[model samples]
Target: MWIAESVTFGGSALDRAAPLRGDAPALADLQARGRIVPLWQGKPLIANGALAWVAPGSPVLAEATAPVFLGLEDGIGWFAQDISAWVPPEAEAVQPGFLDPSLQHHPSLPADHTFTELRAVMAQLSPRHAELAATARALLGWHQSHGFCAACGAASTMVMAGWQRSCPVCGAQHYPRTDPVVIMLVTRGNRLLLGRGTGWPEGMYSCLAGFVEPGETIEAAVRREVFEETGVQVDAVRYLASQPWPFPASLMLGCLAEATSDTITLDPAELEDALWLSREDLVQVRTGLHPCVKPARQGAIAHFLIENWLADRLN
Candidate 1:
């Protein structure tokens, strides 16, 4: 994995200013002076900005529509609000401040939000910006979806900044969780395997992927998923790369697997079609010649992995 960090959402060595989380006064002072952007779901709950490690008065206390805080891994805090508090069209305008260049507007709720499917804006984001955007989007997404404690079914309160939630009644600590998924490009000699899920539009077939079970390893997950979905037995699953898919908080683990057997027993429930495509057919699909299927999304880890594999750049 020499290019592990080269993958999308790979972290930038930002100085998160960890020591300041506990210093209320210093934190307050810094917030006042940092660059601020208003984030609104239904109502503008909070904003994020860059605070000089020394300044004061980001003045977030008064605008405090809600009390949730977002904690960066390095300890810089992002005070947050449950965007669900706001209604739909309004929630779309959340401005989280200083769009750190990730992918097109960091694919946030703001105008800058980028999506792998939205290619026009994708290039606007610098590689580092895309990484940070993915990170922020992922964190915010987790916060939005996991407001209730899983343990006692109680409404959880934000704690430990925004990095965790605590059950007020039972004291259960719920941290942000990233689901593990394995997406692999299965290959047999010069041919590759791609399949489309039941609801996918026409001819689009990307990689075979599934969630990694609680007891399974990444490699095992890759093999199991390929077999279960298309009856393609895979061996020697080699790790390729990973990415942070914030659609709902998932860590997509990418790999390359060799198909030992390919009979195409299509799982009616899992996929609508499966195929062994030669390099030539793949080119047609990529260029939109193959009318039945669409290509893997750009800016997506699946697309990147496949593109690189085709170009022989994975090494």
Candidate 2:
């Protein structure tokens, strides 16, 4: 299929400036002049259908800030503030926050807003906002989950501008973890294969995917996932694209595999159903006329692959 050069969070203009993450003095200065994006329990601040970035002088930054130093953009530093402790009484928690932030008190702020979901607003956000939000969410999630050292069971402190966690007692340095997942667009002649899990909404089918094994290559992962889930043999697998899916941190490896067998043996434990659809069937589905399958949502690599397959753009 066609390679998507610009996945949701892949194409961005921010200069990460990895070396500067270790500069404490520089980081502090950045916090003073840089803009702040509040993440309530890891959900980015959203307003007017986009991410809400707070200025350095904003009351929220000065009063309730627990800022995690994000990278720079256009030479201007950026940070994300964890304000989960200050959620309003009547407001409900959003669906996609990375993990719980232990907040003590509510801060003075406006009564209402549009939304606070990162995935929900990703497609509508600017590339800058999307990249920053994804970075903040993944970084904060790592800190929340890795607060203690695995080696010596010691508490770890945040370091490297929220990029690394260091254990105080063990002196162990830990970095953020990202899981790799192989998402395949398997095709046989003019048809493509799609699978739906047990709990998914009815008629919603997308690419077959599974996590990468310890010793397996991306190509091996693609073939293994397809057979394990659907019992369909595959060959001629080639990589297409990659996407960073930060719902608790996963790197999606998108690939295209040509199925050698037309018959499918369904694995009920792994998939509720798996089937082949022709190019015409995809056209109907994309146009909202197909009855058996609903197209994948926008901004997802699955959607990107399917759209490209229909247009014969998989070069």
Count of steric clashes across candidates, in order? 22, 3
In the range 48-117, model 2's lDDT, one tens digit per residue, is 7676777776655543435677788777888887665565555454432332332222344443433366
What TM-score would candidate 2 get against the native?
0.90
- TM-scores, in order shown? 0.75, 0.90
TM value for model 1: 0.75
- C-alpha root-mean-square deviation, candidate 2: 3.5
Best by TM-score: 2
Model 2 residue 279 distance off true place after TM-score fit, in angstroms: 0.8
**Candidate 1, position 45, lDDT:** 19
What lDDT, from 0 to 1, does candidate 2 have?
Answer: 0.80
- The runs of at least 3 residues in candidate 1 whose Cα sits more than 4 Å from the true structure, single-residue gaps closed, are 17-19, 35-84, 87-123
Residue 187 accuracy (lDDT) in model 2: 97
Clashes of 2: 3
